[model samples]
Target: MKVKAIRVHKIGGPEVLTWEEVEIGEPSEGEIRIKNKAIGVNYVDIYYRTGLHQEPLPFVPGKEAVGVVSAVGPGVTGIEVGDVVGYADTPMGTYTEEQIIPATLAIPIPPSVDHITAASVLLKGMTTYVLVKQAFKIQAGHTVLVHAAAGGVGSLLCQWANALGATVIGTVSTQEKAIQAAEDGCHHVIIYTEEDFVAQVAEITSRKGVHVVYDAVGKDTFKGSMECLMPRGCMISYGQCSGRPDPVPVSDLASKSLILGRPGMRHYTATRDELLHAAGEVFAGVAAGVLRVRVNHVYPLHEAARAHADLEARRTSGSVVLLPAMPAADS
Candidate 1:
């Protein structure tokens, strides 16, 4: 069937995200068809759009969404028609009304969570889960620093870290974002554009620095992020919204015996059990109110380009979700 979807024929600016018609087949064996209720908009989608994370000449950019099982293929069990499920793993083309995804990738959404809320948190929340739990194992009394603390993943990080009993320090460019970060559980909110973050971190930690620094802003924050860490601390560089970070000398890490990791969801959730555990934790967190997901922006699927532009400009906070522009012809 033909569906109205966003396609990138050439990698460039947000302008390259084209709303066009594409044909997709029904789910084959071990796959299921999803009539998407809400699609997730992430910064990583921008990476794919601009070719910073390269794909083929034409491709779909989004990685996650919450949808209903419209059709179940042969041999697909554990899920059936009418079930509400969410997925953050591959088949990479979610900026559409419907998609066929591997059954294994689908995680059922609890009744307490709405489609928009599930779409908002599935990917970002799971990443936060791994970063805090597996990446460094944040604990009570630990000091944590989060770069872009008001961003999609950043907001979740601050809240989750705080819930883990860490004192959260967040850095943002504007006073507005600082407020948001603080509300999300940052004990200290630094307006990086107006103040020096490294110095502020020193003051916040009494010059001892943080136990872990989550730097997603990439190049601009990378060097300073390392400085914000205490001896033997972990630096989790998961994203590069500013640009790829410059290479580091061995001495930079040797000085403090620092640990650096650049983790991706694919790396942490490669196995079925791992994926379910991570996503399950996020869903449970949301249900129990440990994770307060913020769906601050909602755009119709056709206007994803505008969504991308706002995201790149840092004009958006919390999480963003996309609703289908119109219903499927079959529906």
Candidate 2:
């Protein structure tokens, strides 16, 4: 079958995202073919497109999507045709109308969650789950500082941490986003563009600093994020949205007794059991109303280039998704 998708022919700007038709054959053993309903647009997708994360040329750029199984390959068990399923942290090529994915990677989406919500949250939600639950083990009375608080993962992190009885201080680039962060459960929202986040964190935490700093804006905020942490505090730098963080000196950690970690979702969800456990926590949070999946932007699959531009320019607030089955009028 031939499927429409956004293929990256070269590593460059959003223009490199080219809409093309690609042929796909039947899934081999232990694989299932899915017809995508909605596709996720994430900063990692931008990294892949801009060569920040190296990849083979002329490959699909998406990493997450939600769809329905149209055909199940031989030896696949527990998943039948027509099951609503979603997958994240998988290999690229999810930018298509249909795809063949390993059955182990395809997870069953709860019937209560629609395709758009599932696609928007699966990757970001799972990442937030691992960060707050596994990486830092946020608990009552803990204080957390989340950079880019209005973003997909940041917003979820703020809400989840707050619900866990932690004090949440978030940083944003604009006043509008500050308001958004506050609504997302941030007790204190610092406009980083207009103020120094490190100074603000000092004042907010009464100079003791936070228990942890969740930083995704790398180069621009790395030093300040370290300053916002208390002694023996953990700094989780999971992404380099601004740019890769500057190398840290080992002596720096010794000064404050701080611990620095760079975690990846792949490692957090390496085993099948780990994948299900993390994903289950995310779903439970959403179901229990502690975590809300906000899909602030939606675009047609073919307009992926425009979507990337919007996301990179910081025009988007929460999760952004692409609808593969969008009608011509919407496009």
Candidate 3:
């Protein structure tokens, strides 16, 4: 079948993303064909599209989506046509209306969770779970600092950390996003545009500093994030939206005896059981109203170029979802 998708032949700016028809074949052994219901827009997708991440020439660039299984190929089990499933951190090529994915990557979506919600949160929510539960182990009384806290993964981090009884301090670029961060459970929101975040975190923590700093902003915020960490604190650098940060010298970390981790969902949930465990927690959090997905940005899949542009400009907050475009009316 020929379907509409965003394809990248050469990496560059958002303009490189082309909405065109691509042919898809039936799934082979151990693979399932998915007719996508909704797709996620993430910073990682931008990375691949911008050459920050390397890939073979000519490819579809997307990592998360929720869909219905339309065909189950040979050797597949426990999944069938008509089942609603969601997958994140999978092999790229989910930018289209339909795709073929490994059976092992599929996670059953609960009936209570809507497709858009599932698409928006799976990748980001799992990343948040790993950051809080595995990377640093947030606790009650622990002070947490989340950079880009108005963002997709950042918002979930704020909410989850707060629910875990931590004092959450978040940083955003604008006052509007600061308000959004506050509503996401940030006890204190810092508009980095007006105030120095390092100074603000120092004041918020009574000069003691935070136990952990979630710094995804990279080049611009990395050094500042390090300064905001308490001695023996943890720093989780999972992204580089602005640009890659300079490598830290051992002596720098020695000054504070700090622990640094760069955890990715792929490593945290490499096994099937691990994937299910992380995904299960995320879904449960949503069902319990603990993780509020701010699907604040929604666009048709064909408008992906515009979506990328808006995301890179920081005009989007929380989760950004791309729905499959409607079929053109017969003319």
> In angstroms, how far off is 246's CA in candidate 1?
0.4
Per residue, candidate 3 scores C-alpha lDDT tens digits across 101-129 of 99999999999999999999999999999
lDDT values for all models: 0.92, 0.93, 0.94
Task: Please give each candidate's TM-score.
Answer: 0.97, 0.98, 0.97
Best of the candidates, TM-score? 2
- Candidate 2 has an lDDT of 0.93
* Window of ten residues with lowest summed lDDT in model 3: 320-329
Q: What does candidate 1's lDDT look like per residue over 60-152, in tens digits?
A: 879989999999999998999999999995869999988999999998899989999999999999999989998889999999999999999
Off by over 4 Å in 1: 325-331
- Runs with alpha carbons beyond 4 Å of true place in candidate 2: 327-331
TM-score of 3: 0.97
Local accuracy of candidate 2 as per-residue lDDT tens digits, 21-115: 99999989999999999999889999999999988888998999999999999999999999999999887888999999999998789999999
Write down the RMSD of candidate 3 (Cα, Å): 2.1
